[model samples]
Structure formats: structure tokens, C-alpha cells
Target: MTTSTSSKGSLQLFPFLDLKAQYRTIKPEIDAAIQRVMESQQYILGPEVESLEKEIAAYTQAQFAIGCASGSDALLLALMALEVGPGDEVVTTPFTFVASAGAIARLGARPVFVDIDPITYSLDPGKLETALTPTTKAIIPVHLFGMAVDMDSIMEIANTREIPVIEDAAQAIGAKYNGRAVGGIGLCGCFSFFPSKNLGAAGDGGLLTTNDPEFADNLRVLHNHGGHSKYECEVIGMNSRLDALQAAILRVKLRYLDAWTEGRQKNATRYSELFKSRGLDRILGLPRVQTGCTHIYNQYVIRAPQRDELKAALRGCGVPTEIYYPVPLHLQRGFSYLGYKPGDLREAEAVSREVLALPIFPEMSAGQQDLVVNAIATFYGTRAFAP
Candidate 1:
């Protein structure tokens, strides 16, 4: 409930994300969902979890959906189901969250990082061929910042090479590529239901979508300790199950996902319009939506000139901000053994130095967005941008 206030305690500070506001909006439905789950007394993979999987499958237009413990676990489960392990190589972007590549490394597979597209911040499919090798088993293209990657090119390459494509759609659950849902287009799509995700649950949860019946079956078995029948171990797997509480909560949220997405889209559009009107576009690189893709605006990240300075200035204005990632995965200390130098992925590294995310939650008001823009204009010495 604590927000930034003026010296007289009259003004409320806008947060980077207002989960509380979202909660207040849907408190009744959420509370009822939780109470129903409590009354059912089925907290494991019960009716709620089963219903969620079917609903997600229908939403994504995929033939099957498999619920798992977490988004991280979703990636790990996909890799496991695909039988991607030691000596196999998985190609992915170096600019995304660590879990994308960590899933590969965790399974003793090599994460061959490709640079990202400057416009979309997703993997540059042009560089994919160079990263591929005889040992390359799969491709994991992340739909970064809620924008879909160029699936046509990626799918063509994967099909030609006969390698599986696992989409890291943790940020793009409802995003589409050429009129197809993100997770369904790939061989298997992994989505995270982390509290901050577009379709977030109350807690940790994740799911994977696939058209392949065998892959779906394997993912279910893999997530539940690799057993077909109870106490029957068929393959070595980890225990990663989606809790019923999270699933039930997510089911309630799913009904309002489209409405929330529209709100976010409107906010994103308004921010662009505001920035342009204030002449901040010259100094701020706004997010770009691809020709045929729908951007859900999970984070309205912009590339700022002197990002660190702008961030501090915004903080003084009582407007919170976030850096989706200040460091690319290849440059991280733990991945140094991958033999990637600083200049290896120029676009990703360059973006890491300048990308700054402003507050763009679905519940954010136009006045609040104006405040965020005015703060940026003030930082740039534009005096006309008053809230």
C-alpha cells in the first residue's frame, strides 16, 4: 500500500508493477476461487489442475498441455521430454533470462547462444545457421518482451535440419506468430506462470504445449518422477508438479487475461503517443511490434540514452523503473566457460547497457503514464511535459 508521496503526502508514487491494484480489481473472484480450492481439500494434481491444463491447451490452440511446477521446471521438462542431454547442443538467444539457457546447461547440454534482433530483442534467426552443428539437437527461441520471434524462418531451418524447436515463451503466453499461438507453433512451447507473468498464478506454476502426443505424454511422466503408474519408475526424472492452489487461482485469472492484455496494449500505445508528442522519441527507442505478431506488453522496455542517469532521475520523480536485464547471459560470470567474449554478441550487449523498463501494468492510469513520460522529459530538459 506504500507508494511514493509528495512532501505534503498528497501524491502517490507509481510502482513498476501494481499487483496490489490488480488484486483489488478481482478480489472477489480470487477469494472465491481460493475458498473453493480449500473446501475441495484436493491440493495436488486434482480437478483444478486438470481443468487448467485443458483450458490452457484450448487457449493456446495446442493439442495437449502439460502442467508443471514452475516456468523453470517447464523448460527443464521440455528438455527432458525431448531427451536433450549431454553432448547435445541447443541454440538460443544470449539476451534472455538465465532460465532459458540454464535449462540446457542443467541437462549437461551445450547452450549455443545466438545474438538477438535489435528491433524485437528476440533471437536473430539469421545467426542460427552458424550456431548449428552436427550435435545440435534443438532450437529454443525466446519470445522476448512478449513479442513473438520470427517463427517461419526458425521453423523452416529446424525442419530442414530435422531438429526440434522448443519455444521459450515464458513472457509471451498469448502472443501469436502468423496467426498461430506462440507455444503451439514450436515443437513444444514452455510458459511460466510466475506471479509477474501475463497469465500469472498466485504462486509458481508453468505449462508446456505440444502437438506431438508422445512429447506430451513424456512431459507428464517426466514431471511426475518419470512414472506411468504410481510407484513405477520408467525413466529417471525429477519431481516437478503444479500445485492445485496455484492452478485454481490461475483458472480464475485466465478469464480476465484478454481484458488485461487489451488494457496493457492501450497503455503501451498511449506511452508511445505521449513520448512522440513530447519529442522524447528521438532519445527513447520504443518497443516495436513485428508485422504479423501481437505484442502483449509484459514489459514496455525502451532503450534510453544514458539509462542509468534516467533511472535515477525517475526515482527522484517518485516513478519506479526496472531493467529487464543489465547483463546478457553470455557475459555473465557463470557462462564464461562458454568462450564468449564481450564483443561476441554486439546487439545484445549494446541493448543491455541501455534498456530501461517503465511502469506499464494493465491497471496503470493515463495520468500515471503521463507522469512517467513527464519525468523522462524533465530529465531531458524538455519543460513542456507537465503532468
Candidate 2:
């Protein structure tokens, strides 16, 4: 992306995501942890992975936790643990990452797409019961963008039907709902430690949390080639174990998660103030947090009528922006077999066109935020500005 120059003839540029900045902040601790893993020579699922699982379980207040290769695998493991297969259906929002529905499809199950709540951009609990069929096996409600879904309504409907809820909490590690962490609220929560997430690792990694001992045990076995010991096989499974190096790095980062979360929250507040002071809120739709849900701001997305034009203008002015998902899952070519048309989910289709994410990281400075907002102001001509 190209950025505009200042009056003093200096180039300004910002990346969509800056991993190196985070790395530099904790280089020593990360280096030592990696060195320790290399020296130990126990590279597979050893002490480091086990230790991280326990630590995460304690942090989320879950009875058990399991580590896996990626967040995609975490969802698959959860479905496998629950024995979801052909003739079964899994319901989820179409506005989420493909991994949420991909996991269900991989298990030979049908993915039922539902429209999201216009306000929260998450699964609408009111539409859930109507979407359920007699073959519905599980419900995967995503805590989209670190905001907890309407879990009370979802649970009330799900519990009555005896349908399991798998929370796709990849972006909401530290978020809470009614004072309870998002991961432990449902039967199982799947998280992603992709380098860009709020609580991320150096490379691809994921974790799952659950309160049921039997489900946790089943997940552990499924992620480890279905074997409890060496040279023994119990059931059909896949190779999706978490690496020791990733576990070590994650442990170092976990210590600062709360602090970083606070930073993000502060930045979100500042953005609101800046937009409101400039009257940009009249043109853009700011995020809304529910009363009982605490948002972690995994992404600070705003809706603008001229989203595409504004994004181009921001790029020209040295501010980079990204679209979380340009298209919903049901309309994807691969899922065309689901027999969905454009009008099936009107809200999701309309939202996919207007949502745009601005730069939001824990290490970002206030000046950088100003630069971003200034660029937007210049584009919309909302307030007088100089290039």
C-alpha cells in the first residue's frame, strides 16, 4: 500500500499488522524461552505444552485445555470429540472466518448459515431456534471481534434442545460475558494463536477449553493420532499437536496479555473520542458493546457508506486498512452446494460490503492513531485539513 507524503517531503507508511514491534518489546524473554526449548531436546508434546495447557485452563477457569496445530484444527477436534459426522448439521454465523464452518464440513456434516445480529455482528440468538433441525448436532457461536455473543439466549435455546455449543473464541481470549470468560461459557471454546490475534504466538497455534472431563479426554486423544501411549491406536484421528517452541513463546506473551488488553481498550476509547470530536460518527458506524459483555477489541471495525472509496483514500494518505471478510461463507463458490442464494441472509451480505478495520495494536502510539484519523478526515472532507 502506498501512503501520502507530508508537507516537509517525508514519506509515511504503516503496516496492517506489525509483528516485529511486538517481538522487539520482549526479545530477551522470547529468546531465552526458545533457547530453553532447544536445549531441553524434548521437542514434541512435552512439559512445555502440558504446562501451557494448565496455565490456560487456570486463566480461563476451565476444567481442561488442549493444544493443537491451528485454530482450524481446534474446531475440528471439538467436533470430533462430540462425534459430529454425516447426517448431522452445525449452525453458525456466515460472517465469520471460514475455519468455523470448514471444520464442520471436514467432518462430513452440513453447515447451516444464519444471519448475524446487526448490532454485534455475531450470531443472532433469535434466529437460532428457527434454523435448528432434528439433525442439528451442535451450534458454533463465534465471539466475533472479541465481543461475546448473546450467550444467555443461545444457551436457553440450546440447552432445551440438548444441542452442544462450540464457541469460536479465537479473537476473544481475554474477553468476558457477565463477568465470566468467554471460553468456558459454552460446552467447548476454540481459540487461535495466529500471530495477529490478541494473545498470539510466534507461529500457528491454537487451544480449546472445556469443563466436561469426558469431552476434554476425547479431544486429547483425537488430536494425538487417537493414541494414549506410544505404538498404540485407539481410534481414527489426525496429527495436530502443538509444538513445544510455540508453547514456550506463548507462555512469555501470556504474562503481558492483560496489560496489552488494557492498552487496546484505551486506544479504542481514544478512537471513539477522536471520531466524535470530529463529527465523523455521523458518517461512520462505530462498534457497540453490549451491557454485560466486555469487548477486547481484537479488531476495531467501523461501517462507512463509501467503504471502498474511503479505504483507497486512506491508502493514498499513508494509512492502511483491511476488510475482515469481503464475502460471507454461504456465497463462497466452494459452499455453493449448500443451495444458498444472495438473499438468503440479507444482513450478512449487506455487512460484508461496509465493514472496514483500522490499525489497532497494543503497541501502537497515539500519534499513529492521529495520523490514521487525520487521513480519514482528509478523505471524507468532514473537517478542514492540510495535506
Candidate 3:
């Protein structure tokens, strides 16, 4: 509902994510939170970190939450807790941030990728069977673009196979599926506090959520050098612990998260309405929400006709755009060892070429969106729209 006066077709460009705007609104509280951490002089995992973990667990409706150094570390710790090691396979979609699969490979395990659902652009539960094998230890379904995968279908398949599901929910902190928060739906859910995330910290921070107490206990140990007691290491583990400073900052930001999510939701609705009114829906693919799901719109991505060209055109028009993943993970040079050819994962490959992210941050002005849409209209040679 925040509008901007049209610059008569000369739109002023802005950062894709306006973190400063977000910071300004909560400056006093953030400063106090930082001061608290500084005064305590307890920089590592301590009271502040433990308190944040409890808050996150309650927010996600999970039985327990474990904090880690980064989102990548969260995945690594979760896989370690499950004992997924050499020769083991973890199923995930290739159309996501590399950290999703990278964490699997870092543990000397294989990342077995499946195709994505064309409509949802997430791991297609239908094709999951094709990727499962005797070595399959876990299924990692990434909730891409802040939209939850069909949790009902995914859970049914995983439960039948007796395989654990780890949700890659770094982009979906506030998303929900069937009235349950995404991080709580899967066996183990991972979240990131990178500055760009919806619930970002001051820097790198991550959390793991689960209903299983045993898994929670193990994750705690794994995140803390695999020792139930200090200097008595039970197993191999890394030094991945969430620091107190980031935790304190996150505690403050978590309070305003719901309001921010609402702003993003409203922006998404306005974009869709504008696109439909301009008859751009026929040419561009607006986001689709499944029944009983809440998408946080971390990135309001659209499937454009000429995605790369459109992105360039938008840039010329003082609009910024980004391609989430130009290359699917299976085709990446590092993963070529997996021996995947070009068309192996058809839907993922196709989506990689067509998807482009628009600016949908909660603080984005209405005129910024209008300019982006009108610029796209001009690029596609559709009649340009005016506010």
C-alpha cells in the first residue's frame, strides 16, 4: 500500500533488499541487544544463544531447537546426527542454493538429486521414487522461494520408506504447510540467519528444529564437537556453534518478523493483481500457492518468457533482478562427478533458464513494483502500463 510518484517512466533503482530500512525501524532495540551481548563478554554459545533457541523452537512449534554457526553447518550437523556418511545418499532437488547439496557432499556422502514439480518448483514427490535407492539415507526437500512443498505427499512417501526428511527451510522461516510451520513438519528442519534471509541475524547463524528429543540431544552434541561433556569427545564433530552476538540480534528481529511477513504478503498480492490487470499473466508466470500453505515470499520469482533478456532489460530500466540459480546443481562442474547429463532433470533444467526474482522485500515501495512491472511489459512488447 506504500506508493511512489511515477518519475514519468524514469524509475529510480534501489537495492534488491533494503536491509538499512529494516534496521532503521528497529535501531534502538537492536542497539540495546548488541550492547547486552557486548557487556556480557560471552561471545560464544551461552545464555543469549540458548534463549534464542528456545524462542525459535516455540515460534516454529517444534519440540526443540539447536543453534549452529551457519545454515550450512545446520545441515551438516543434522546429517551427522543421522549418521549419513560415506556411500550414503541424500535425495534433494537440484534447483536450489548449493549449500543444500554441498553440505551433503562435504560429509563424504552423495547428493542424489530428483526433478522438481513444475508448478511448485520444489522437489516433486512423484519423481522421488526414481531417486531412492538402497543407499538412500535421507530426503531433503527444499522449500524454495519461501513456499512449502506438498508436505502431505512428501511425508506420506518418506514415512512409507522409513526415511527421514530434512527440510531445507533457509528461505522459508515463516512459511507453513497444512497449518504446521515448515521447520516443524519435517523430521529435522534447518534455518539460516544470513543477512539476506527473512529472519536474518547480524551475520551467519543457523538453527535446527525437530520433534524428536533424541535427535535434538544428538544435534546439540554434534554442534558442540560431538561431546556430551566438555573435553570428553564421543565422536567426530566440527566447531560450529552460534555466537552470542548474532543470537542477541536475532532475538530482537524475530519480534517484528510477523509484521514484515505481512508486508511481503501484501506486496505479493499487489504484484499479482497488477500483472493480471495488465494481462501479463498470459505471458508471465506469477507465483502459485498450494492449498493450506503460507508462503513468506522470500523471493517473488516469476517465470519469464525470455528470462535473461528480461533481466537485462529491467536493469537498463533502473530495475534490479536476479536469477536464483542459472545452473542446476547436477550440471555444475563440481557435481559433474555425479555423471549427470544436460537433460537428466528436465523440470529443474527448464526452470533454471526461465525463473527470475523480482524485488519483493517488505519495505519495497509500491511505485518500485509498478516500475518493475511496467518495465517488464515494455520488454515483452506488451502495451506498457501506467499507475
Clash totals in order: 1, 0, 0
Estimate the TM-score of every prediction.
0.97, 0.96, 0.96
Clashing pairs in 2: none
- Superposed by TM-score, candidate 3 places the C-alpha of residue 287 at a distance from the truth, in angstroms, of 0.5
Which has the higher TM-score value, candidate number 1 or candidate number 2? Answer: 1
- Candidate 3 is scored at a TM of 0.96
Give all candidates' CA lDDT scores: 0.90, 0.90, 0.90
Window of ten residues with lowest summed lDDT in model 1: 3-12
Instruction: Encode model 2's per-residue lDDT on 63-108: one tens digit a residue.
Output: 9999999999999999998899999999999999999999999999
Candidate 2 stretches with Cα past 4 Å from truth are 1-12, 385-387
Least lDDT summed over 10 consecutive residues: which range in candidate 3? 1-10
Instruction: Quote model 2's TM-score.
Output: 0.96
Q: Model 1, 1-387: lDDT tens per residue?
A: 357653444434866777888999899999999999899999989899999999999999999998999889999999988889999999999989999999999999999999998888889999899899999989999999899999999999999999999999999989988899999997999999998899988888999999999999999899998898789999998889899999889999999999999999999999999998888888899999989999998999999999999988887778888888999999999898888999999999999999999888999988888888888998998766755
Residue 75, model 2, lDDT: 97
Misplaced by over 4 Å in model 1 are 1-12
Q: Rank the candidates by TM-score, best first.
A: 1, 3, 2
